[model samples]
Target chain A: MNNRNVILVIGAFVVHLLLQVLVFKDIVMFNVAFCFIYVGFLLLLPFEMNNMALVVIGFIAGITVDIFYDSLGIHASATVFMMFIRGQWVKLITPRGGYEVGAAPTIKAMGFQWFSGYVLPLLFLHQFVLFFVEASGFGLFFFTISKVLSSTIFTFIVLVLGQYLFYTKKASA
Target chain B: MRRLLLFLLRHRAFLLFLFLEIICGWLIVQNNSYQSATFFNSSNSIAANILSVSNDVTSYFSLRTENKDLAQEIARLQAKLDEKPKEVILVDSTTNIAEIDTLEESRYEFQTAEVINNSTRRFNNYLTIDKGSVDGVLPNMGVVGGGGVVGKIKYTSNHYSVVTSLLHADFYISSKVKDKINLCSTKWDHLDPSYASLLFVPKHINLQVGDTVVTSGFNSIYPEDVPIGVVSTVQIPEEATFFNAKIKLVNDFSRLSYVHIVQNLMRNEKDSLESLIQPENE
Candidate 1:
């Protein structure tokens, strides 16, 4: 990454972290749905970034939120697990034309339909792993699953809002 | 050797993922152990400082409700003062000087604190108070709100302390039915913050809806007769020896903003006296 891009990514991570800790940490909908906007940091990374680097970044991002949530390693485990599976996810969702090397898989880079298809599954996977790991027992099975479902929808809405507000579609020309 | 090197290089990402996952898993296990989890909780200085700043902004919204709670507390205290005794109990005045001096030396001292961070939705909820060891708050100190028992202090940093709230899983308070000899333990089921189950009440004891529950004073941490909750439901399982009473907690944890930490001044003395029966305990 160029110095400017690196600075922008770090700044984005900091903003996401601050939003997660200072704002979203207290926002619970019906005591189930939770907004985890920090996951956007990992999702918005450049497509061609190294897989190893992605996992490390995800771990760091997760731990930053974990520190504030008082959830020690739960978020780290889920985020890293999601990052580990991200490579396979990318291969599964590859377009027939394939991705351009420098492009990010954002709603702006790809069309809205493509972006929704790409992000939804990954978001659900992260939410599923996160809430289950947090619940930590089979006794909370139904409660945890409901939490995962609601949180996935809640996080996806926030992600969509963020993408539309900040991300711009550049001309292929 | 070249093939093996290439294979290792190719799978390095997966290997790193595995390594990080293991480390995080270890941390999760350590955190659940409860004894050494203090450093990873919100009571840690960095997290506490940040939350305190955020609380400063959000606490403004709750000012009206907090004022109401404070006013109610003052009224309760005023009523107690208004009910002064008509006559002195002691007829003899000779030894009353020494007795009065000892009575004035209360065993429990109260320290006021603001709850900068609190969560009720979590299964194991905790409240972070903006006072810590430096402010004479210590681990295991009993914390109470205007209505009733809040929790026990779990960890402390320089300027903050985490209370393992009454709504937490595995939290049990020794309690008794008001004006009754029945002693039982109360615990939250994690399903609801408003209710906790009173356990080990003998089946024959009659319990009414709205019967008061209070701290039993069996444990030195909390003083006797601190209101905990009111009986809301009574259940007796078939062939079971005990009645389970669900209590509606008086303190609404979702709106908790301020609390008082109870410091037992006579804790050392009480502990030393109790330890004589089990000399191995230090």
Candidate 2:
């Protein structure tokens, strides 16, 4: 990524973190579905970003949210785990002709089908680890599973809608 | 050695990931302990300021209900004041006797604070109040809303304090049924925000629905007889030794805007005296 792109990414990071803590923190539906829109920012990092940098960024983002949530390390651990797996997941599901260097994995850059395939599993894994870790064990097996599934769907829908609303479509390579 | 260095270099990202996770694990464990003051929480000055600003914007929407709740609380307190017996003073000029103090000294002092941020949907929830060390608010002080028990102060900074809400899964308060000698513990079931379960009530106690639960005063943290909740459900399995009961919490956590922190003046004395027995037992 260019210096300009790096600056823009940093700006987006701040925006996402603030919005998550301030606006989306209070937005819960049915007492189960939670909107973790910050995850969208992590998922949309430039495709050429190094794994090490991605993991570090994820830790920073998650820890920031954890502070506001008073949840300590649950979000950080979950986000770090997801970021570590993201590189391999992206390569495994690379579309025909592969991705353009420095391109972001957004719905606009990658079509809806490929984006869903790419983002859904990663989002699920993130939420799964987060809720389970917060719960501390399998004691609330069904309840935690329901929370994970509903939150994944809730976060996924908001993420897609947010991308469409705020993110401008980049021209095809 | 070169081959080992190359292997370590090749897996350096994974190693870093593991290291970060270990740090996170340590943080999680460290924060789980009660009354361990730490900085990364919402009670930190910057986070609390941001939350208070956001609350300033959104609290206007709830002004009507807030005013109504405050009015009701005032009316309740007024009724309690009127119920007290009137004091009579006798003049004895011939003896030149000094009058004894008629007013009873209260052990608990309360300070009002605004709730800047709160959450109920999370399994372990916390609240950030606008009061802190500057206001004499400290960790372990009991917090109560107009309706009933809110939480216990967990951490405090200069201008803000975080409360471990009653809705938190790990939080438990010593409590008992009103007008009964049997003591039980109230703890959140992590299912609903409005309800918490009462544990350790013996099966033969004959608990009924709608019984009021109040603080037991067994701990120095809270004053005795603070209303916690009203029993909503009561059940006992055939083989079980204790009754399984749930109480509908009096405080509506989602709409909580203001709380009073209960400071027990004699808490240090009580705690110190209790600590004296520990060494002999060991």
Candidate 3:
């Protein structure tokens, strides 16, 4: 809707791309870097961005990562669904339009506490659906659960780090 | 109606999220196997390239270890050669075998080849070797490395063939105990490639930890008596008929370079007769 929003979207997308190509791969010690790329779109959606658009972005983000990880559609689908819950996350955390003008609700924009609300629930949902779909549903119940919980923690930590690095507390508007 | 409209407006994101989740769920269901995506191609291709590069750098580093293993294998083979040679000449199995017969010796022809590409991490995994049909690497031949059975050949071109790693859920190898006292199927537990489980061995059998497990080679993908792994842990869940024996693999699939692809000289004759006996392949 505005210049700042476009920049955020474009900038986050670029960061997501670089993360996939250069980082978050093969270094299994952190394991959570597996889905950290999607956090770019997860953290940077514009304040006035439509929920449907965000979902689409999530889907796109998931699919893009899936393409490289060779995990197939597991990511695309998980991410789109993640985008779906983000609005309620914003509302629950900051209420109506709590974000400053032209500033996102990332860690830099809304501080750590504000971003945590967005991070935790969405991270849980994204990972749960992601792992569930990846396991083809309900087969190894404990495995799917462990994967979700571990991956959620990993995704959250990386997303927070990305937000700290990327988000800016500015009002171009 | 007005309440519904207000609810929809207030909770649009939740509603949409649910919808997208449903779509993802449906797509997952459509894929019968929880096939991790084709992202493997990109990562694997790059990784294969990186491995080739790293193989260049690390080959120099690992030459000592590789040479050490090779030296050990040579010593072992020399020791085996010192044993009294048993008389094992194959007669016509169908007609003359009824008269007088001792234990059939496992015939094996070894072909040396370099490991071109291999992967242990992915769901549906494949390994390629430099030697192929041109080098007498026919389909269904057994491949071994680091004193452990790696896998069987799936397909072959002139110079290369795809061998499915035993680490793959889709890959199953017929194997059992060395003494033929216990028979079980070997499988990767999907936890680690370095460890696999010997399924369907009943709890009734005496399976101690550190017992050697080898290829019984009944159906003959591999020669009888090739090493697989040692029993790491034995589990007897009360609800199951089979004892779950964990096997600590002897081969390090990650750092593989050279291997011995074994050719069964009598495979075709055995297979043709086998097809006539059973309607379905065991």
Candidate 4:
């Protein structure tokens, strides 16, 4: 809603997309970098972000991944599903004191323990939804489970890396 | 009504997200058209041309071996020529041999076109041969090379004819195992190139390893006794009434070099027979 928050989400979204297209595409080894880009959607949403904005962001995020992966829109479905579940997740994670004003989510904002708790659950959700959609299309349980597990591990690693690079305490949450 | 409108306004973003996702999913499904886009695959043509050029460049270095092989073939043919009976040459002039002219035309009565494009990886593997309508290639003709059976013509342009290779799951050649007298059709398993499967062979038939498999004269498309492959493994499940055998293909398409396409003078009659018989079953 504010200029800083809009710039933050939009900037992260664009860079997240370009990295998936340009950088992650070239890295062929473990496919870790691709899972991280999807984290941008989860990470950019504010503590008390609007449900509508979260859903919109989720669709954009999934479509961004969809364009590069060339997989017939599996990411979009999963990403929207993740957005729908994020509200309940926030309600659980948010303290009685509630979210601080004008502070974007980070280790400093929610503390390392709380942040990990937040990320791990949503990462699992996103990875599970995506892996299942793709695997369901193929009708293979082995492939689906392997994909979800591998993607979750990769997503966690990328999410941690994303936190390191982007999260900096401006005014101290 | 005002409350409903307010509820709709409140949930607009979720609705939009679903709409966008459905649109994107639909777009992706639409993009995956079954028929190959002629324009999209025109780039594949360029890639095929580049690949042919690249092969030509490397093949030029192998010219000595190629020439040696060609000369060896010529010498072998020449040796066979020596054994020909005297009256056979006289009778040839009185027959269809007189109608054919030109060095290229005389050799095989067909062009030895380079297989510029071929894919043996799909369920229905189609081959794109460099020979086309202009090169005297036509629909319903047969293509063969180092391997016994190559494919049949599917689509043709001025300079290319897409062939349905025997490796295609969609490929069903009316064939039989030579010497074994096992009458059945043959098709590839879509997994391996060095292997194919024989279908409709009755369980009562005797199959043996090293038994030569060839085209049955039942199909006019291919000359009888053309080698398809040998039965490597035969399986007859107790519940199954028909026998299925795995065949070891003689020609490995992965290493295809030169191919010989066969054109029958009476393809139309046989073609109609197949088409007429095809619908009767279904």
Candidate 5:
């Protein structure tokens, strides 16, 4: 919205991408699970941002990770799919009171239960599309599903921990 | 017309999503288009540089193992050299020494390279070597490592080349069982990096475990008699006419660090001469 918020968003994008490319890119657990915490950049964007903008941001983030992973457009396709469905997901999980204007749907703003409910499905969807696209196109069926499930859980844990460690609750709320 | 335009304007976001998704799908599935896709793959200069630097750091950890492999190779060569020299006596009085020497010239040139980037996890694996077109490396050259045949060069940038490893799904090499007339083709199943399958072996040929497979030299790409693997399993279905043979690869692909690209000097000549051979009457 404002100059400060735009700067903050850009800063977060760079930090998330750096960590993804430099750190998380190589973090394959037991040769099964991969942690993709960079999806947090899209998950935490301010509410009411245009869906088109969300998709573009998701594309940029996905491609950034892809450049390092050497998996062209696999992550981008999954990220775009998740962002395309994010609007419906938000409406489905909306609280009775509804989200406040200009507030990000983050753990600090939306509370632990709301944030988990909001993030879990989107995260799973992203990982599912990613691993399946990667596996079905190039690997076996059952092996890919296992990779998808394990990577989803791994990514979820990292995103939850990241939210708690980085964002604090609003004091005046 | 206005209504149609308004509908398109309203669903433009969805249209954009579909458009971008199509591009993504194209990139994922059509990664085999090598000419226009160097930038997206690891063969690009920036990606290759980063991988090379990382390899430099990791290569130190394997220095001891590499030394052992090098020692074993030298010992093998030394043993071959120490064997009794068998001189061929020129019985033909008309044959000159100069002409005979020219016939013995080498047909293949080799250049060493380091494996800067390699992967064994994917169905179609590729290796990036530090040597490229600038270093006399070219597409279609055969690569070999510590044990035996590795792969063939797929593409080459200025300073880097991408090798489609033998473990890739599409890689197949013509081989023969050592000391036998049996010829077969070998291919990886993408299930295990260390094992591959031997096809087209006749049912009449009795196969035993640990029979070595080597290049047949029928293909211009690889030299003859380069050891490829050894037979690990042989299965004969009750009514089948061919033997299903499993081979354990000689090269440890997962630990590959160094390789040599075989630059065949007579490839063009051989190919042209072979292409001129036509069927008798058909």
Candidate 6:
């Protein structure tokens, strides 16, 4: 990515982290659905970004958020795992012409159908690992599963809305 | 060696992921254990400061309820003060002077703290208070709200402390049914924030709905007879040895703005004496 894009991504990272801890932290619906909007930062990173860089950024973001949540390592492990798998997920869904270099996987960049396919499963996996690990095991199997599903849908809705409001359709570098 | 090096290079990313996951697993395990005093929690200065600012803004919305609770607390204290003289007169006639002197020396000291951040929807919940080590607040101290017991101090920094909320899955407090000597444990069932399960009550004990539960003070963390909750439901399954009872917690955890950290002044002496007897039993 270029210097300007790097700066922009960093800015988004701080914004997402701050909004997650300060605003979205308290907004749980019926004690099941949680809005973890910070995951959107990882999901929307440029496709061509280095896997190592992505994993490191995920670790930093997760740990910072973990401090605020008082859930040390749970968020970090989930985010890093998702970031590690992101490269493969991107490769698995390559379009016929392939993605443009340095293209972000935003809804504006990729159409709604492709974007949902790309983001939904990844968000599901992230929430799955997060809630189960926080609960320590499948001891509360059904309850934890419900939490994961609801949180995934809640986070996905917020992420899409955030992208629609803020992200502009920029030509790939 | 060359082939091994190639394999290592090919899977370096996976190796990093494994290594980091191990670290996270270690942190989760370490943090789950009692009183580890880690610096990565919300009690850290930067996170606590941000939460404090956010709380300052949002707390204004709950000011009316907070004032009402405080006024009620004041009225309760006034009522107790009015009865103190008659109790002292009866005690003077019935008890020895030495016993009265010992009773007058209060064992628990309370320090007021503002809750800067709190969470209730998680499997494990915590609250960060604006008081810390500098304020004489330490880990393992009991925190109580005006209404009832809140939680215990989990960690303390210089100016902030994290309390393990009573709603936490791992949290358990020694409690007993009001006016009955039978002791039971109060544990969060992880289903609802307002209710917690009362465990270990014998089947023969007559447990009724709406029975008040209070801290037994068996562990010396909380003061004896402090209001915990009222038993809301009691069920005895067939062939079970214990009754399955639930209590509606007295403290409204979501609206918690302030708490008092109870420091047991004689805790060190009691703990040291107890430690001396443990080895003999072993």
Show where candidate 3 strays beyond 4 Å. A1-23, A29-37, A91-96, A136-144, A165-173, B1-144, B151-165, B168-171, B191-193, B202-206, B218-224, B235-241, B253-282
Q: State the fraction of real interface contacts model 2 keeps.
A: 0.77
Predictions in order: lDDT: 0.85, 0.89, 0.67, 0.65, 0.81, 0.90
| Local error of candidate 1 at residue A36 (angstroms) | 1.1
> How do the candidates rank by lDDT, highest first?
6, 2, 1, 5, 3, 4
Q: What is the interface RMSD of candidate 3, in Å?
A: 4.9
Q: What tens-digit string does per-residue lDDT give for candidate 6 at B50-81?
A: 99999999999999999999999899889979
Writing each residue's lDDT as its tens digit, candidate 6 over A35-146 gives 9999998888898887788888888999999999999999999999999989789889999999887788987778899999999999999999999999998999999999
- DockQ each: 0.74, 0.87, 0.32, 0.14, 0.49, 0.86
TM-score, chain A, per candidate? 0.94, 0.96, 0.81, 0.85, 0.92, 0.96
Q: Is the docking of candidate 5 incorrect, acceptable, medium or high quality?
A: medium
Clashes of each: 0, 0, 6, 0, 0, 0
Judged by DockQ cut-offs, the docking class of candidate 3 is acceptable
Name the regions of candidate 5 deviating beyond 4 angstroms. Answer: A1-27, A37-48, A64-70, A100-120, A135-139, A158-173, B33-37, B87-105, B277-282
- The TM-score obtained by model 6 is 0.97
The digit string of per-residue lDDT tens for model 2 on B56-126 reads 99999999999999999999999877865343234555676645453324778889999999999988999
Summing lDDT over every window of 10 consecutive residues in candidate 3 chain B, give the lowest-scoring window: B34-43
Sorted by DockQ, highest first, which candidate order results? 2, 6, 1, 5, 3, 4
Q: Model 3 over residues A24-122: C-alpha lDDT tens digits?
A: 543343322244555656656667777777877787677566544434467778777667667656666675655666556666656677667667887
Select the stronger candidate by lDDT from 3 and 5: 5
Ten contiguous residues with the weakest lDDT in model 5 chain B: B96-105
TM-score of each: 0.91, 0.95, 0.66, 0.52, 0.83, 0.97
lDDT of 5 by residue, A21-135 (tens): 5567657786678888789888888887888898888887887767556577888999999998897788888899888988888877778898888888898899889877765
For every model in order, the fraction of real contacts preserved is: 0.79, 0.77, 0.45, 0.18, 0.53, 0.77
- Candidates ranked by TM-score, best first? 6, 2, 1, 5, 3, 4
Give the per-residue lDDT of model 4 (tens digit) for B100-155.
23443232344587765454433344555677678887666788766467877755
**Candidate 4 iRMSD, 1 decimal:** 7.7
Off by over 4 Å in 1: A169-173, B1-7, B84-105, B275-282
